[model samples]
Target: MSFIRGKKVGGVIYYSEVENVRVNGKVVQKHIRYIGRDKDNPDHIPIEKVHFGYIATRLMQGDLSPSELFGMIEKIGSHVNRENLERIGLFYDFKKNSFSLSLYRKRLSGNQKDAEDVKKG
Candidate 1:
């Protein structure tokens, strides 16, 4: 379900890890992680970068609770995206136009504010 995709643009080859998913009965390919360009050694990918898809998979498997998941997301900040969760096997019900994480909002919101306050101080 996951594979490498490569594209060449102006002599630079870029690659990404992609996953296939079914959306509205249509199979769509989504990018998981930007693996970097051929010009740059992919093996040397930065340590600071966290793959949200992998974390999402852990959360889906219940290996991490929703509060832990949200904490990781807040730590990663902008790097998190809906696509990452979908690639990790989450699905969106377009008819409902909703996600199920509302159950976690109450659990995580308070802790998140405390974390923010600690960071600010």
Candidate 2:
């Protein structure tokens, strides 16, 4: 169950790497990945990670949407198995762009303190 639309909620996601707690609002979706043995025809499993990040280049100019962020996370979930993927949707406000691994586009940001606190209990 997700409390993204109406319910006022915030909780911790136990990813493979750093555990991250949602600060103000919960993500809009759950199980947003397509990973498995099959590359062409893949299967998705339920996964949650915190404080993870990946590198992504700015393809279009616009604000990173919640869904897009989640999808991006899912895509690279395997790479950052132990860490939160942060660079994929990480975008620069002025340039209206996102992050990238191969290209130097923007810096992926996250609140490590919050993630640690949440993991500590």
Candidate 3:
């Protein structure tokens, strides 16, 4: 697992992957934070201040998009009238791949090149 730092915006927390780290000898896939609504005990927190573990967990899973995640909470009866805040959070999800801003950028550039190469190949 890797620990990453994210920046906070209005209300949403944005987690930018820091480094690839190992946790309990397992590789972390992704990292994220909950912005609106408490996943575990929705009633425990106020409607505006809700985000909980569930949202964070979902982000880690990479299944739900930031917008969709918040929409789900609202659909379920939670109310959050705000934009996605860019809050900084920690991320520790990496197995073999070391996650650094430079590395990530390089990989993306490489991927684009690879795609071009594939067309020529």
Clash totals for all candidate models: 0, 16, 25
Assess the local accuracy of residue 74 in candidate 1 as a C-alpha lDDT between 0 and 100: 54
- What's the true lDDT of residue 25 in model 2? 82
TM-score of each: 0.34, 0.20, 0.26
Task: Write down the lDDT that model 3 would get.
Answer: 0.43
**Per-model C-alpha lDDT, please?**
0.50, 0.35, 0.43
The 10 consecutive residues of candidate 3 with the worst lDDT sum are: 98-107
Q: Compose the digit string of candidate 3's lDDT tens values, residues 3-66.
A: 5465667874554444554689986555433222323221122222134445556768988685
Q: Model 3 misses residue 22 by how many Å?
A: 52
All-Cα superposition RMSD per candidate = 15.3, 17.6, 17.0
Candidate 2's residue-wise lDDT over 48-101, tens digit each?
222223222223435656466546646855333323323333223234233222
Candidate 2 lDDT at 20 equals: 33
Model 3 TM-score is 0.26
